[model samples]
Target: MKPAILFSFTIFISAFLLFFVQPLAGRMLLPTFGGSAIVWNASMMFFQALLLLGYIYAHFSIKRLGAKNQSKLHIALMIAAAVFLPLSIAPEAPQWDASPALFVIQTLLVSIGLPFFVLSASAPMLQSWYFSSDAPDAEDPYWLYVASNIGSLLALLTYPFLIEPFLSINEQKWVWTGGYALLVLSVFGASFFVKKAPAAEVTATAQTSSSWAERGLWTLLAFVPSSALLGYTAHITTDISAIPLFWVVPLALYMLSFVIVFARRQWIPSSVWVWLAFAALVPSAYAILLALLEPVGLLLGIQLFSLFTLSVAFHAILVDRKPSASNLTDFYVWMSVGGMLGGVFNTLVAPAIFDRMYELPITLALAFLLLSMHLPRPKFEPPSVSIGKAVRAKGMQTAFSVLVLATAAVGFVTYMQSVDEVFEFTNTMLLIGILTPFALWFVHPILAGFAAATVCMVLPMGYQHQNILMQMRSPYAIHEVREFSSSVGQFHSLYHGRIQHGVQATHPELSRLPLSYYHTSSPIGEVMAIREDFYDVTPVAVLGLGIGTMATYVRPGMEMTFFEIDPQIEKIARDAEYFTYLERCGEQCKVVLGDARLSLQEQPKGKYGLLVLDAYSSDAVPVHLLSKEAIELYMSLLRPGGYMLFHVSNRYVNVRQIVVNTAAELGYVSYFQDHWPRETKLEELMVNSSEWVMVGRNKKDLELQIFDPRWEEQEPDGRPAWTDDWANLWVYMAW
Candidate 1:
């Protein structure tokens, strides 16, 4: 093969494996970590940190040992890394309530750190080697970066659409190992194409190392998009589902930006890039900062467009400052450092400080300011002109300044009086806060950026403060207790993001009644009543203790255990200020703090007569809990004639299909109901339409004629089952 082909092929494969591991690692950690999106963020931090270390090694090695010897050293390292292949996380992993971010970093380091480090160095390392090759185009080796990112893009896309839907996690690991082995051989073979003389040639021709200022600017450029990637990802995943497909799409687009900006041709004009970025940024900022839009499809589109445009704009500017091939490793080192810092800021810092999803808007505003500085400024010519014209210009400028200040004042007042309703005075504030800055860009780009940042910061605080009785932030998700009124009387609702988890009435008698997804007339409520009446189902197990609403289901004599993932949720459930469900259950209810899967395993086999899986109804469902392996695990813990319940109330995903399909695949009799409260007006009480599926081993165990009007028996529909190995949630996405 030609030197270019060999080098490009080697870098491409390395990049492929590099990005492939991220989603795979996330999938592995989902069940253990309670399927919180924080696992992905922490894993990203570790990946970026390792990537930085790899670039540092490449920078020093290429400078000291030169390309020939560096290739030999890298090859040996790759061979050594293969010993850790056929990847699997340690069995001795942390419990669900253990410091999640630290645990993620620790497990990833022990499992795949060395292989990932070796792979991370390949792009910069091989590009340097190719520069030392005698190919005609070797002088400009930057084209290889485009090839590398293309491989990364394809690898990310392949995981969800091709690999994940087909291969089991176990199978994918072996495939990754084989690819790693082949990557080492490919790199070793490619080294033979490097010309010995060109090492001296590059040394002689290369420019001096980039200045400190240039390095600082490169790092700043990289940090914005890196932070936004996590911020936007966490935002969307919270509302829809925190599966691999959602994770992959943003990163794939982030990679695609590098490919577009680094390629030989510029598809978008340089002058238009900043404006394009600002255009996308304003709406996205508004959507997040103000609760202006609630539709998942619309918000997903706006934010994704903004993330892509901002990435492209920032990268295009960064590419213009690229050093020669000799300094490329140094350039990448700073970029990696910036990206690592971004992850640190989101995973470590933001949750500690900000109580809401503020990071995305902050990142967007900062990026807009950076992009604005790049615009071609209008030349102010103080030429000879009529005095009257100058006076008129000054008068118009004064009028504009007055108008801007007046608009800002009205916005502040409107926001201060804003209610939780979207269009009730909030939309007026959204227009003033978001669109004003956007329109001002034509007049003064820098001023618009400043206005944007101000809007991003000041607007959300006022908006979020309204009617929020209690709020808490955790690494996993933000929890809110807000007061709501219904015909049933005064009540307080618990929320995780925009999704209502549970509701409790303040009235003494009404407090014991299950509300929200678990209301008395809902599907889950029907299951509890039937189980209590029909079977001697003692010691029920309920996964996902949202506000401990299911604690109300424990009858006087029987005991129930609630498996909750976030300790923060546990704390609030126990607090008398917001709820009294756990207080009411007393000795009849026990709570376990950790992932449901791990905690469930600690229970003896055939331990429970009733096990209710209630985690799916959240804004984001735990996909790992819905797989075939998960079903089997639940079955193991159920008694001979025990029953299982699956709550699948969701707007964006058809989780009901997944449960119905998986249970049927295991040859179990199941009952499903998408319960809508129609006979009685739904608004009369604190209730929501819910969908639940009940599965049991014996048909006789599940046959309940009293609730036949609501519950329908499930039959196998021939849809492929989702196993621990192959789960394609996107195929079932409601979009």
Candidate 2:
């Protein structure tokens, strides 16, 4: 068989096996990590970094060796890496409360490290090697490059459909182990062609080694797109329900872009997609803003699709510019550097630098700049333009500018007026939507894409039901909004994931009443009303005030303090007037701002019968809150034998297991309750639903009294409670 054909097929299988394992391993860790974007990004960073090291190693190691020596080294490494096969690594489950970034990096290193490094570099290493030895007439390893990407794309698409539902986490791990073994054998067979002779003479290739400048360019091209993909994923998941398979679509589309860009036949040229990407950027940004401003479900979905399409287009542009086969290893190594750089930027840097969603726009601008740099340099010939055409172009430009400013103004007004009752938002958005087409007329498609996207951003904020109840933007975000439907006198409230971690009912009456988690069915409600001669509501401190759902538990004279991360949620609730938990509860609802866990640490010692922690309204619970240190803080704020209610309802994992394990470690008597409130009442104007709460109490007479029919008396074999240092996600992956 021809060397290139064999080489391409070999690399294809290796790439397929390599990427197939990524999502599988990521899925296995999801329940414990809560499917946070950080988990995926951080893991990618580790893989990329390791791949970068491999490429550098291969580039340096192969330079002095003959073709035969290269084969020997490749086989030896592949065989050495095979020891990790049957792919079992120690410490299978992760401790949920540990630093996810650190934990993901550490875990991936031990379990899949050697094999993953070998796999990640195989495509580039083999391509470069074949180009050097079997060179005279072989096709540019670039076509074979397309095959590698196609394999990656197929692997990503296959996992969610073929692997996830059919197999349990351990089963998937074992399945991948079998594939890894086969991949090694295939790679070994392909190594024989390394020393094959070429049939025809050829043109000169790029230098076998990459220079510093070339490496720098590779880093630039790679880092930005990687960061952009990660940032977009993070932005979406932070505000929406974090369901399973969220990252798969984005990554699958990203890999598919390679099929379009690098294939032997061009399906979509770089020119058309570059224009599409440009067109998409402004609108995508605007759509996200509209989704954020108005809080509409359909709008958010549209925004996500738009962003995904544009991100794929942008990444495809990078694949089009990849280095020649001679520098293939160096190219991938730098790409890994870029991936690492992007990871650091998104996970650690952006959060610390920006307070709002500024990273989205910054990334858009960065993507635009990179595209602009890649455009062919203009000719030095004299510029030519008809007088009439120039005039028309100038007029169009002015009109486009006018429309953008006008739309931006409309957007600013909507955002500012979101907290004001007198402003008619729907009327404003209607006007903006009407003015949209005029902005696009006579404008370039790229610019028009921005304008159209801006239109999407501006028009949605004025929709009638866009009543955002609560929005908070902190290091840890939480945005809880309520959509009002007076037809049934119902209000629908949703927890906007991390964007709004804690909620203070902005509604006047509902502010003090425990509404969300503290509704009538929860153990907190029973304990508050019946007190059972055991608990009361005096001097109550609630860690997370989600829609002020727990405020209903507060009596006329009770003092309730709410700690919230986002101020926007508080402002929205104040203006919406629909949620009355705070309004009806009187002057006793005091809203505290900052991280709830940190806020609790600062509060003075106080004796309270009820210390409610309603932090887990959504599935993505803050890791810090579940730690041993955090439990101690909750205990510190409670009086002896105080009834502490924790909200534990989630769609992602069995929350009761973690809470049960946590409570057992702390020696607190804990009980679980399933609270699935009717969706109708949650949407009604006045009907407030309660959360299913798990109640835990301090020991009586220095003895742990395990009660409540919902719990089992068995202890957890003394597994230590999660602390900042010892927490790992693998601990909870047993689910």
Candidate 3:
């Protein structure tokens, strides 16, 4: 094969493995963690940081060892990395050792670390080698990146729709291993065709060294999009299920940006990208701020388009600022540095700085702010028309000033009025629309962008409805407390990822009452009531403590061990200001903080008579906690004839069949209730809809009289059980 084809083929395979392994490995590890959205964040951080390290290694390797020897050395390293492959977690790896984030990073490093480091290094390393080669076009190897990102985009796009649906995790691992072997062979074979220039001569032939300022710009440009990728993906998987598909989409778009910008044709003029980014970013910022992220089509379309456009816009700018082939390694080093830092910011810093999903707006603003410095000055006007141009510009500036103030004034008006009465007027888009037109009118990219961001940021300050009382964000998920008042009285409700977790009445008489999905007549409620005698005598283990709502069921003598993944949830629940379920549980509530599955394993076997899986809300259900293996683990923890209750209340996924099927196939009796309450007392209680499943060894264990007629016996379905090996969530998703 020709050198181009030979090099491209090798780069493509390496890139494919690099991208493909991310979701596959994440999916493999999902069951180990609680499927918290943070897994994706932590995993992204690991990948980006590793990729950055790989780039630095490649840069220094080429500079020190020369291109030819570096490739020869890399071939040996790739072979060594293969020994760690056919990737599966080592059994001895500690689960939740120290911290879950540290565990994920450590586990990933040991499982696929060396291979991934070598593979991730390939794009830059190979590109540098290609630049050194004697091929006719070797002088410029930047186009090879298009090939790399194309392979990356291919892996991302296909993983969910093709690979994930068909292959079991073990099978996927083996396939990836096979692919890695092929990549090693391909790279080794390509060495014959790729002849690098002498190290001294190659260095002398290339362009001048880039200054720190240029490198800093490169880092900033790369940083915004890298951060945006994680920020957007985090928002997606947090609100939607943390399934691989949602993760794949944003990442695929992210890869596509690299492909577009690196391709020979600048798909569009860089000058125009600023305008296009503005159009995309503003609407997206509006949706995120107003909490209008419906799982349905249009809003998602807007947000996704924004993610793609911003990534492309910022990356195109980065590409345009690239130095010659000599600085190629240095260029990529800075870029990956920015990318790594972006992951760090999203995964670490933003959680501490903001208490809501401000990622979309923050990233959008940063992109524009970074781009503003690079905006090309309009071609100098002829002296003859300079006066006319000056007047026109001033008029536009005046218009920009008036429109901005008007937008701010309108927001102030909304803030001044009774929020209940004027809530509809507080649309984020409407206020942005007022100023956006002036931004289009001869405005400087920096000033207009900052003004737009300012308006958007302030507009949300007046973004009040009658209900929501407080919002807090953690790396795992966003927790919201909303207040609702009616003819009867007032109640404060807690929500995570927009799904109501628990609620408590402010009224002193009704404050202790369970509401929403945990209503007394509800399935989990019925389980708590019917099995109270057993539970009071036997300790109860709650897998998910959503604002500690299930803590209400713990009797004075009964020990309820609440296994919660997020400390934020415990904080809100324990605080008297929120729902106060844990506060109400008082000494009866014992909280075990970590992944519920891992935490549950540390508990004494057969100590609990009742296992309540109240973790599933309408949003962000952790599938691992419901698998066949998970069920067995739960059963082992329960005393003989103990019951496991699942709160499978979800708006998007139909989790019943999978959960019930897996349980029944395990030789367990299962019953379920679709407890969607239609009738309730008007003045006192609010019972939101819920779904529940109960499983135990015998029907008698789950068929207690306290379980009203709402519960029905679950008949077995011949469908395959969802094991940790092969759980295809797409088959069960209602979407």
Candidate 4:
């Protein structure tokens, strides 16, 4: 095969392994940690950081060892990494009490440690090999980059549609192992080719390489857009379900950008479209803000639109910085480095730096600046007097200028209207129509772009009839205020991603009562009802308060406490008057606001008879709280035989096994009961949801619960239980 073709094949296998492993590992961990945004972010950060380390290693290896020796060393490493293949570090049951973030990182390192290190270096390493050993006539190795991203894109797209639904966790792992073996063979074959060709002299000039200042620009260009895309994804999926599938859309768009930027095609025309995309960003971003303020539509429109803008900007910048084919692999190494920086900043650093989503606006602004810098300067002359020619020029300029001014004026007017104020639909539609022509015009492109952004920022039309619910930017999430008119009692809603994760009714009577999963009608609620007879339960600890659903189940005498990760959900329930669950319950409800697992560890022992885990539904399971160690924590606080109820009704994974398996090992017997509330006459009143309560008693009972078919029967494989030291997500995909 030609060097270029071989190079493409190498990049292809490398990328497949890179992305295929992400969701595979994530699924493994999902059952243990209650699905929270932090788990996803933490996992991504680990991947990026590890990839960076791999590239840095490859860069130095090539500089020091030359081609033949480097290939031999790479092949040996791949074989070593294969020994650890079928990546399985986090056991089905985990042992230690580690934060979800630490657990995810440690798990990734051990499972794919050597393999990922090899995969990360594959693109750069292969491109270097092609350069040293292959014919000079071969096409620049940079085209391999296009192939690598194509493979990455394919893997991302395949997971949601193909792999995830068809294959179990174990199957995915074995398949990945097969791919790794193929990769090892491919690299070894390429190595044979590397040695056969005559060795070329290593020039000091090539060895020394470029300066950081030159490289940093490429890094910044890559990092900013990459980070912005993730931030946008997070903001959209914050309250709703962040199913693994949702990740594909943004990542595909991101990869496609590489194709456009790196391909030989001239991108000036493509950029024209991107410039127009900026205008749409404003409207889309405005829609998102509206959703954040009050849970309205899925924010699907906003997410798709913002991703489009972000993708355009990202691709445009990359197009401007296309590396020569000879340096293609090296260029991508820098790009990946930039991506790692962005992930670290967005996932690891920024969340610590700023409590809320202040970084979101900053990312948007940066995208705008990057796009503006690369916009092609128009070649048109200044307006001049040449009779007919002048008239035509002036007409075009005037029409475009007037349209921009009108759009800006409308945007300003829209912003002036308070969120509570109502407007007619027709007026809002007219405002958007008038702005479109101006936003599309190329005259003063940046100014036009700004006008378009303004249109997005001020959503005058979409908000016309929508009720404004409570809106606040909490440390962990955005809280929304909701309202409903006389016909159907209004509801205050808390949303994360597309799902209405939490809902509270406007009726004062229901406001103080936890109505959703925690209602008395559910199996867990039934357990809470008779808890007084079991023991003297002083402090009743609740992990998640979805519209204060479980608060209604609390008895009058016991002190009720709620541990909520998102303060937005809490504020919407308490202040919006959407649901009166908290008020109706009437006990001074003390909300221990933070991660439930973290908060539980800080509290006094022997707190209550019942501990509820309702946070997993409406979101991916939080891997941290579901681990075997977390179950032990709940057992520690409970009096002997004090039962624990877990609500596990998920659309994706079957969580019953994890609970049954973990509970059994910890010496608790559990039983399963399915609760489905009857359909009511009021359509708004009929919210259909299910809960599976796993009741486990003390040490003797915990064992029985594991074997009880009524609850769930799944055994721990005796692997290291998820501890602070290590946890891999690949093991629990079956659950």
Cα TM-score per model:
0.90, 0.65, 0.91, 0.71
lDDT of 4 by residue, 1-735 (tens): 766667678789889889898877776765555445666677777778778777777766765676678888888888878788678755643333667567667777777677888898887777667766645634355555677788898888887567755676778888999988888877877776564231224443233344577578778877877787777767655643355346667667777867665565654566765665565565555554444434434466656666766676665666556554434445666877778877777766766665445565666655655565556656556665577886687578768776656654555455445433534533464456445534445565565555444544344334432454444554355445455543446566665434555566666665554455555555654555554544544566778876776666556677778888776667666753456667666655777666687668767676675677776664445666877778888888887656677777766645665676667677666666666676562334534467575656644544433343444434445543443223343344533
lDDT value for model 1: 0.80
Better of 1 and 2 by lDDT: 1
Better of 2 and 3 by TM-score: 3
* Model 3 deviation from the true structure expressed as Cα RMSD, one decimal place: 3.3
Clashes of each: 2, 68, 1, 53
Could you arrange the candidates by lDDT from highest to lowest?
1, 3, 4, 2
lDDT of 4: 0.63
Candidate 3 local lDDT, 258-327, one digit each (tens): 8888887775887677667766777677566555656557766877788898888888888888988877
How big is the positional error of residue 381 in model 2, measured in Å on the Cα after superposition? 16
Candidate 1 clashing pairs, residues 3+ apart or interchain: 168-725, 169-725
Q: For residue 411, what is the lDDT in candidate 3?
A: 59
**Which prediction has the highest TM-score against the true structure?**
3
C-alpha lDDT (0 to 100) for residue 617 of candidate 1: 59
For candidate 2, write residues 546-596 as lDDT tens digits: 556556666667888888765655564455354556655668788886557
RMSD of each: 3.4, 9.1, 3.3, 7.2
2 or 4, which is superior by TM-score? 4
